[model samples]
Target chain A: MARPASMRRSRRVGEALIERSMLGCALLSVVTTAAILAILVRQTGEFFAEVPISAFLFDTQWTPLFADKHFGIWPLLAGTFLTSAIAIAVALPFGLLAAIYLGEFATPRIRGVLKPTLELLAGVPTIVYGYFALVTLTPVLQKFMPELSGFNALAPGIVMGVMIIPMITSLGEDAISAVPGSVREGAYALGAGKLATVFRVVLPTALSGIAAAVVLAVSRAVGETMIVAIAAGQQPRLTLNPQVPVETMTAYIVQVGMGDTPTGTLEYRTIFVVGATLFAITFAANLLSQRWARRFRER
Target chain B: MQTTVDSDACLSPPYRTMEPAQMSNPGVAAKLSVQELSAWHGEKQVLVRVSLDLPEHEISAVIGPSGCGKSTLIRCLNRMHELVPGATHRGSIQLDGEDIYASGVDPVLIRRRVGMVFQKPNPFPTMSIRDNVLAGLRLTGMRPGDLDAVVESALQQAALWSEVKDRLREPGTSLSGGQQQRLCIARALAVEPEVLLLDEPCSALDPIATTRIEDLLGTLRERYTIVIVTHNMQQAARVSQQTAFLLQGELVEFTETDALFTKPKDKRTEDYVTGKFG
Candidate 1:
């Protein structure tokens, strides 16, 4: 027999309420993202109105807070790229090797314990990493290279690399594990050793996913703030020398965002412009990674 | 396990202490011999003391109902069974006259001599058609003298060269299921293995594809010793010269395909062949 009308009506009301609440939760993220984008765009527009686009884009130095006031974003861009490059150089090989070991060589018991322990690195606060880079890593590096600065790009870049290892490892391991057993069996049947099978079949098959992971890690590196702000000094110099100090876009924003600059000034507006540039770079990287991941699935 | 002692007796220099009933054919020499082979996954035994002689340069078929250890038997032939976690085997298998499972014998080298095709088509998805055919040599780091010639010959042997010749640069996964299976066959052939083990290779194919593969296998039998595990009785009869029927992990009947189908020696074999029960 059908349920009573009153009970059915009450059940329908409950279902509608749950559906509406779920939709509201879904909409919340979209609304927050749109608001962030709007703020970045509007403030960036105001900043650019005062500072010429050419000066912001092609200038060689960034000194918005100084009396000399050169607003070139190139130094910040260079510093950001240099640190991220260092991070990728450190993290890529280590992360990929760890992923291969965890996915291919390690037994289930070992992987179960190791993967979460490695991921625990991701759980540590960023500010703690910042202090570690400044206090622990910088002094260690200084012992080897006597000329190394107390606050330089190398220390923070290395720390950032260590911080993002779990991101690459977790995602890369998932990609490697997703390769079918039949493909691996085919390789083994052809007399391929574990190394050959891993390198020839598994790695190539998981290349797209691994690449996406690396790109995501690069994006994370590019957007990282605390470690760079603490260890990479506020010297906005357009140089690739890791031994010297450099300032990143995020680091510059952190410098300004600490309530030092007056409200509604050109220095304050620089924060939005730099933030916009960072958003654009990271957004492009994320888009490229997503596209690559989708292509891998389609194939 | 009486067959274990008989196989041990045959292992000596005499090599002729075989029971007349155990042989598939009197004249043909065995290429690979399974002597009282048994296998287990963890603690659950999948194959019970089974013995068979796969004649050189001929097709042998293992037929059984689901989970009757037909696939396990063929996997044992190539040492592929031991790859599974907690999977173990007892007894011995010999290739030519060498014990494949002897201490210090590398399973990797054994595998190169005995290649396998699986139930599903598993061409490496990232590789080009030509690369898939050459994957065996390339993956094993065995440099071929003439890459183009090797690719052509292997694909030709698998009967896939003509269809895929123009699209060698295309990804292997781009081909149809049958073409992909043939591609995998070409890959297995590229290594120039002495024996080929196929586990239900045509189970996932259509009748036309199945017919194509059967015809291809007929040609392949002249060059390589083949063991195929099939669930379809007609397929076993159509493609194999020798047929072995398995039930509940035991080898019930093994003889000439014609004799086994027409006049099964065991009652269980007779019942299975007559479609009485699995």
Candidate 2:
């Protein structure tokens, strides 16, 4: 029933080689992350030397291109926060409700037809979404409020929120469905109705995964460039009002990258400094999300 | 190839009268009665014309091989089988002479009266051990005024109070598998159901854990009518007052556990109990 001794020994050797190669392939992604960090840190060190960390962090105005330049980080940081907060506020409730509907309420026939159709929203290009926000959503909003700007954060934020709904909903649905079927049966057997079982048992159990999904969505919103660049306008100002124009860090990067600023210049190097800040914010969020997801897995 | 079973052949001496413990209280009636039950998963049939009577405050064990509808029969009693997509059934299951499947009767109400434990322990992972015991009451909208007492009593009844009392705040998943199953049992007991259905509760447990659960079941039968489905024939012989042997979705024998084990009437029942074949 067993393989011959020499043949088995050769098979074991072949398997060990395959395992080592597969492990090496897995390490490639880690190496890529390290390379990105190395490049960003080296450039960021050079920029901070000339800009002085105090002025970049404390100054209120960010008029780098004007005759008198002030390199304050708060204005861009505020812009990123305002747009991402708006996007998350709009997306989280709708995404969670859609996930619940898809996971618990829908019949198999309806879910089969609806889930894929909803996920298709994720397949649309971000540039197309940018175009839609700038041309279509802005005009539609201006109809109700005539004072609305041609380029504003609200339009782009709302469109970006819509773009993020599929990601949160799909991830949340996977989390909910992964709660063992026996858990649902236990609740049902305890005389809990569909709503009670879903809210009390299913939702609470999948909370960590849902929270992780929301964090990923927030990171996506923060890094979103095309939509903010095209629709949120080019003015970097310290404002929390979504109705006004503001430039995010990503939008600033896009602007400087498009303008073809000479390499090694302070203006060109500013992008990497801003990029380092963005990386820190997203990296912290990702760490928190991963921790929560890991705790969920311990169950 | 003998398919048909005789009702009289399966009837033992104990079937004519209640057991010695119930003889002093002869006024008690059958707690659950299933008549001509047939169930289907979409177009494929699973249970066919199965009928049995479970006496009040007693343990009844349903024993059969895999795919013999042992789980289906118990799931049908609490209407849990209906939760599966495309699962349908035609049966008259009466709880205290009231048909549970009648148009006016709600399954939620039926389930409240008849709580169930699954084959595997499924304590709410997000909840604490203390909260897990009170899950039924919280989920069912009948929040107890004496929350501490209710949790203590339920855990006590499930024989897990002493072990979990110190770590009541810990997550339910932190417990061992046997402890988790008892936590699930405590969760069911908190609802104060008239009957408890256990579907292969010990199948996932080790022998020591199985013995503990079996002992708990013996005590639980004093207050609540209990029905268990187990594949282990020895388990049925050890724990049940009445044993029902199901074969190919039909009730082949329903008699006292001792009588059925010692003198099985039907050829199929004898073959199965003797371990000659499934």
Candidate 3:
């Protein structure tokens, strides 16, 4: 009943070919990631050979494109953190509340309609969000605060917060739903109402997943280009004020990337250094979040 | 002489009711009285018109085959059955003469008065052992004056205090399966519930753990009116003073455990007890 020798050899060859093709697909992503890291490191190294590392880290101004060049990364760093902080402040409460409502309290019929509608916010193009911040949100805010700038960090920060709400809501809901029903039953048997059970038992159990979601969303906000560039003006200043113009690391990269600066010049190379710094921050945040999630699971 | 006869008739009813309360130990008042209770999950009926009286400060066991709706019966006791989507029930369950399912009665309060321990151990994985013990009180928003004393008393009652006292801050899931089940028991007891319901609590445990919990339940019977649903006939005989035998969602017999095991009146009960058919 065994197959012929020729047929057996052909099947083995076909299986080996399939295995090799799958291996190739798997290695493709690794190769692409390594390549990106290599280019960033190489260019960043070349940029640093010309500009002093201390000046890049400590100097106050970041006007490399202007006549007076100061390449301190502090201004960009400050602007990035300020906007990200504001975004997290807005997103944390709204996203978490929405997730809790969807996961714990909402009826299945309501969740069916509401969850898709919420996620549609993520599908809207980033350029549309940027324009909305610049034209609609900024003018409305200026009506209240007459001194508000035409292009300011507040509008973009708020818009970015709205843009990332779906990410947090989706992830948080999954985490909350993953908690076993028995735990909730135990809580209910103890006379805990819906809200009490959510806050006391469900929230704490889902904390690790929620933390990972927030970190990933923050990473997305840090790398976001259009909203910040269109609304947060290219005025790199080391200030925490949101009413005035600011330039984030991402926004500066967009500015220099589109400009007519010579590719070999120091001004042009500044983007790679800033990009590396941003990458490092986000990479660390992602690593920390993953570790936290793993530790919670192990426990 | 006629008036004295009427008064005697009125007084004799109490003594008459006490006669059938227990064959061996009479006069123990009923803590929970379920009368003509029927339940359904979605469209499928689970429990038929069932009537039983659980004695106060004693252990009662419900024994049935799988899918015979014994779990549903106990869940109906504290109104936990209605929590499931599309689950419905008729008739009334009275806890100390108060109908738990009456209009304007909150199921939440009923559950607090009648706490439950499930078959599988489910300690809040996020909370510490100390916190798990106090979860019933803290989650219900009552901050007791001395949290440590409550934890100590609850753990002691569950017979888990000596093993877990040194590591109160450890997560509740860090313990072994039996200890975690005991923690769940402690969690249920910490709220000082009047009635404690257990649904096949030792189905997932080893014999040694089962023996420990049975011994613990023997001690718990002095304070809490307890009802346990068990599939094992020996477990029901060993741990319960009163035993109710159920088949196909119908109550066949309820009497003293010794009588139910040794001399079941109903033929089906005899078959089940004698292992002729489950």
Candidate 4:
């Protein structure tokens, strides 16, 4: 066999091969995320020039409210935040407890059934759920609060909350499960009971991952469209009252898109502006989760 | 209850029969007696019928080759063996004049009185150093007023107080390998148990750290009964008054340290002592 001409040259060749493999995966991940961002920015920028970014982000009246220069975004922004908050409030206890049940308390047979069923919930189409919320859920909820309209923020928010339950439960369960069994055993060996072990030992260890899961689900909730469009009224009111009609940023985009508005016109351009803002908000949430997760990674 | 029978015949060694020390201080009492003990995990029996006695306030060393069930036997003392789904034991062991496995006795209480140190240093990761020491106290349900002294004494006993006193609130894992092991020892001692069972306490430590732990073990023998499981013949020879040699789950011999190391009674023990095989 022919030997290498020089040891130094051969070592450089080996190092280059290893470096290429290491950076290849990193490059792929960075490039993919960058491409998606670039596409959103390019398309959204074109939409913004016609509408004028100021009118789109900070106007008081959102109409098509008045037809000429009534470009308020507060209504949609408020609606999105309100719905997401409500969803978090509902999901925090229900989804987290469900995750706890599955991760800690459930027997194998029960866990086998529950996890996939939660997954099935995640797989259900938002449009179909939208129709269900508008027809079945709205009327049922209206009976409890007679003042509630046929299409209201509460119904859409509740549906959105239901939509995200699996996101919270599944990711939270994974975080809880990632806790090393030795940590749990240490607590158990100390004579701590199951609940004490879970709450005091397991939960603290898993908190960062769970927090990341919650932020990600909130991002998903903020970016939801079809269900909110179908069930939430397109009033674009800056109100926190759940029973009242409100329009989310996503819902308004769909409302504008579906109508006969001219494609490159100022009114039409507002949709992309809304889309860019939605994109920014979700990106911010994603970054926050990533930072929190990295900060808490085991040393 | 004790005698000096130059034990080269019973111990695995570089057997050095050191100058004689006083026999049976008579201060330490025999706390546990093991009889016809056998253990199995699933269908595979891991330990043969093994028997030995552990006296209070003295260190008893159990040594053997890997997989000889040294760890399983210690775990049996406090009922940790039952924690494994398929593990089962057949035998009788008495702690403090009471049968630990007898009906009506609580393993929880037995564990509190007979604490353990793991092979690797596992200080509870989530707790502060002070909190880690007090974990056993909290497990047994202690009021805050009662914890301060217990935590202080336990750390002092483990020889970790001087190193960690300034940073009591720091996580237990922030400590180095030897420090973590000593912290774990402090945690076990926090409950003020009568007996401490160490399963290879020094196995994960470096030579200097091993020497520190060995010194701590000798000092600790003045107050608490310690049953140590070790692979190091020098460590057992240096620290243990009574040494039991286990070969393939069987206790081949148990005798005074000097006698066992110098004049082994069994041929297998002699062979092991002479480094034919561990």
**Backbone clashes under 3 angstroms, per model:** 0, 0, 0, 19
TM for every model, in the order presented, reads: 0.94, 0.93, 0.92, 0.86
Q: What is the TM-score of chain B alone in each candidate?
A: 0.92, 0.91, 0.91, 0.90
Per-candidate iRMSD: 0.8, 0.6, 1.1, 2.0
Clashes in model 2: which pairs? Answer: none
Question: Taking the tens digit of each residue's C-alpha lDDT, what string does model 3 give over A175-201?
Answer: 889888998999988888888998989
- CAPRI-wise, candidate 1 is medium
Local distance difference test, each candidate = 0.90, 0.88, 0.88, 0.82
Looking at model 4 chain B, which ten-residue stretch has the lowest summed lDDT?
B16-25
Most DockQ-accurate candidate: 2
State the DockQ, from 0 to 1, for candidate 1.
Answer: 0.74
> Cα miss at B75, model 1 (Å)?
1.1
lDDT of 1 by residue, B73-177 (tens): 988888889899999999899999899999999999999999999999999999999999889898888997999999999999999999989999999999999
- Candidate 1 lDDT tens digits, A1-299: 49899999999999999999999999999999799999999999998888899998788989888899998999999999988999898999899999999999999999999999999999999999999999999999999999899989999999999999999999999889988999999999999998999998999999999999999999999999988999999899999999899999999999999967888888888899999999999999999999988877775
C-alpha RMSD by candidate, in order: 4.3, 4.7, 5.5, 5.4
- A best-first ranking of the candidates according to their TM-score comes to 1, 2, 3, 4
RMSD (CA, Å), candidate 3 to true, equals 5.5
Off by over 4 Å in 2: A1-24, B1-6, B9-28
Q: Which candidate is the best by TM-score?
A: 1
Q: Which residue segments of model 3 deviate by more than 4 Å?
A: A1-14, A296-299, B1-27
Error of 3 at B143 (Å): 3.5
